[model samples]
Target: MLKTYSVSLAVGILAGLIYAVLDVNSPAPPIIALVGLLGMQIGEHLIPLVKRLINRQPVNLHWFRHDYHHKIGDNPPPSGDKTS
Candidate 1:
């Protein structure tokens, strides 16, 4: 997760530098860009979810915690951690 965030920050900084050097404005405001990014993250899971539903597979908290959530984010809590 740290690696992911670090790389993203680095890329964003590089993009900002390039924009400054080129004197080209970002195409969208920051809020709009953030919303677009949120949409993209949601969209990434939609297809797999739809396929699972179409196949009549179970969708539940256990499935989410064990399966879906990890695919979208960081590693799950360790097995011995009951708080999860």
Candidate 2:
């Protein structure tokens, strides 16, 4: 989880810097903002579509791998599992 967070932060900063540079030369701020927002929406939609097309599978979230771990968090062993 910590690793994922760190990577996400790096990607987010890179994206923001790119966006700022693009916006700086834009002729009209309002129009540019609208287009930027639309571009974001299209990119969001396209990413999952491209991913599905490439992988040919539904995406699985990382957290589901440990569903059982979360459910029994910090619990002591049951009586039947006695140690010798």
Candidate 3:
């Protein structure tokens, strides 16, 4: 995730620099571009949920648990050690 964010930030900075040097406005205004990005992000998250629903699978939100160590590349705590 950090790598993805870094690459996106770099590309955005480069694009902005190019536009500034050319003294040309961005083809899409910032707010319009932001809204498009928001829509894309929403779709990215929703697609999986929609697919799961179509397949009649329960939507699992286990990853959102406070003690979900998987996100840190660590083994999840043993079942007996689970805080919840």
Whole-structure CA lDDT of model 1: 0.76
Candidate 3 lDDT, 1-84, residue by residue in tens: 999999989978886787689675776588866875787667766776687679996665553343433534566655664555
Candidate 2, residue 71: Cα displacement in angstroms equals 26
| Top model number, lDDT | 1
- Write the residue-wise lDDT of candidate 1 on 5-79 in tens digits: 999999788867866787767865788668757876778788878888999998887677777676666888458
TM-score of each: 0.56, 0.39, 0.43
Positional deviation of 63 in candidate 2, in angstroms?
23
Candidate 2 local lDDT, 1-84, one digit each (tens): 999999879967776788677666533478876887788677755765577669885544332222222333545444464332
**Which ten contiguous residues of candidate 3 have the minimum total lDDT?**
63-72
Candidate 1: segments with Cα more than 4 A from true spot:
1-25, 80-84
Q: Where in model 2 is the C-alpha error above 4 Å? A: 1-16, 19-28, 57-84
True-vs-predicted CA distance for residue 40, candidate 3, Å? 0.7
Quote the positional error of residue 47 for candidate 1 in Å. Answer: 1.8
lDDT of 3 at 42: 78
Clashing pairs in 1: none
